[model samples]
Structure formats: structure tokens, C-alpha cells
Target: MLTYYMPPKTMWSNLSKETLRIYLDQAQQAYNDLLIGNKPISVSYSQETGAKSVTYTQANLQQLQGYILELQRTLGINRRRAMRIRFR
Candidate 1:
């Protein structure tokens, strides 16, 4: 008999659910840019503006990996439907 082991929740507690959501959002943006064949998108910040803004294709790979993991959390039915809808 084989025993499967799952890691403790504390290992992931450092990253809140909201953080995953934010990373997923960024991944979607990067994918959209990739679809449009855009490269090296610009990211800018301003002290007076109190915010940063830009449009480009550069994305954090670690964040994207996390987003992929998030997508993997979904079931097969929903994942299949999403893939079909997204491509068409």
C-alpha cells in the first residue's frame, strides 16, 4: 500500500488568497498581450501621481506559475468549458 502525503496549509498561509487572485489577473493580462503579439510592455511609476501605469508584455513568471496552479485547482468540466470558450 502507498501512502500519499499532503503538505500542511501553513506552507501556503504566507500568501493570502487575494495574492493569488492578483497574480492570476496579471497572468491574464500577459496572455492577452501575447495573443496580440506584443512584447516588452512598459511599466511606470510616479510619486506625484501616487500610482503606476503602463502596457506591455513583460510578466512575472513566478506569478504566472502560481496562476497556472490556481487554474489547476478547477475541475475538469469547468476547465474544459473554459478552454473551449476562451479559444472560440
Candidate 2:
């Protein structure tokens, strides 16, 4: 049983690159699991200046994929390949 906790968006900026990468990897794994018909538990947390709140959501492919993309963007990871042309 795999459980994934989504850190608050505010926390993302405070996270180190390695931490973001870990989250990205976990999100991708959860996305793949959902594709294979497995529903993992997804927990989310929200924090205010003086209050903290927690919410639970059913794992969905799209959400996980979106999170992964967000993490990649934060990490400056570009997946697209550049095409090169050679002039003789």
C-alpha cells in the first residue's frame, strides 16, 4: 500500500531541488499505478498564517501527471529534445 502526501503549494518554493525531484518521482509512480488499475491514497495539506488544514483525495491519473509536470517545471527540467540542422 503506497500513500502519497501532497505538500502545500507554498511549501514547494521552500523545498530543495532534490526534494522536488523525489516528489516528482513519487507522483509519476502514483500516476503509473493508477493506469494499472491501482488506486493509491492521496493526501493534501494546506497551511495558512496561523492555521493548517488537511484534505484527502482519490488518486487520479491527470492530477498526478499535472503535479509531475509542475515539479519538473520547478526543477527546470525540460523534457523536449532540440533538433539540430547541419549545413554542409
Candidate 3:
């Protein structure tokens, strides 16, 4: 059953289903963190060049958030379940 959601044209669009799922989870987590006014998201990378090892960090808060929103919009994830509460 095909729903109305389609993947957009992005760098991560071609990822495997499992990889995409992992990224989606991470993106949602980062979005929630940002909403709660927490620290910026960071991704670390280490490179080796024969006799040299360099380590650096990439601050990816905005990018991750943008991708998350884009994914949500393109994938029709904007729907929220209705909730009802009653106290007597």
C-alpha cells in the first residue's frame, strides 16, 4: 500500500530503508533537543593521512533540523492523533 509520501531530492534521499530510519530518528531527537533549548548537535570526524590523524567536529543543528522538517513535509508526517481527556 502506497501512501502519499514521497522522498525529496536531498543528499540523504537515496539511503537504504534502515539507514534512513536511523537518520530520521536522530533528526527527530535533535529537533526535540533544540525545541527544549538544549546544546547544539555535534558530529565528530577523524581522518588519517599516513602519519597524521586529525579530529574535528561539525555543528549540524540547523541542517539536521531542516532535513527533519523537509522529510516531515514531504512524507506527510504532519498529522497528529486526536486526544481526549475527561475528569469527573
| Most accurate candidate by lDDT | 2
Runs of candidate 3 exceeding 4 Å displacement: 1-9, 43-63, 72-88
Tell me each candidate's TM-score. 0.37, 0.55, 0.45
Compared with the true structure, what per-residue lDDT tens digits does model 1 show for residues 6-81? 3334323345556545544665676566657777544433333375565544455454445445543421112332
Ten residues in sequence with the least summed lDDT for candidate 3: 48-57
Model 3 TM-score relative to the real fold: 0.45
Output the better candidate (1/3) by lDDT: 3
Runs in model 2 deviating more than 4 A are 1-11, 43-59, 79-88
Quote model 2's TM-score: 0.55
Tens digits of lDDT, candidate 3, 21-71: 555676676667766777665422222322322221136555666676766
Per-residue lDDT, model 2, residue 69, is 80
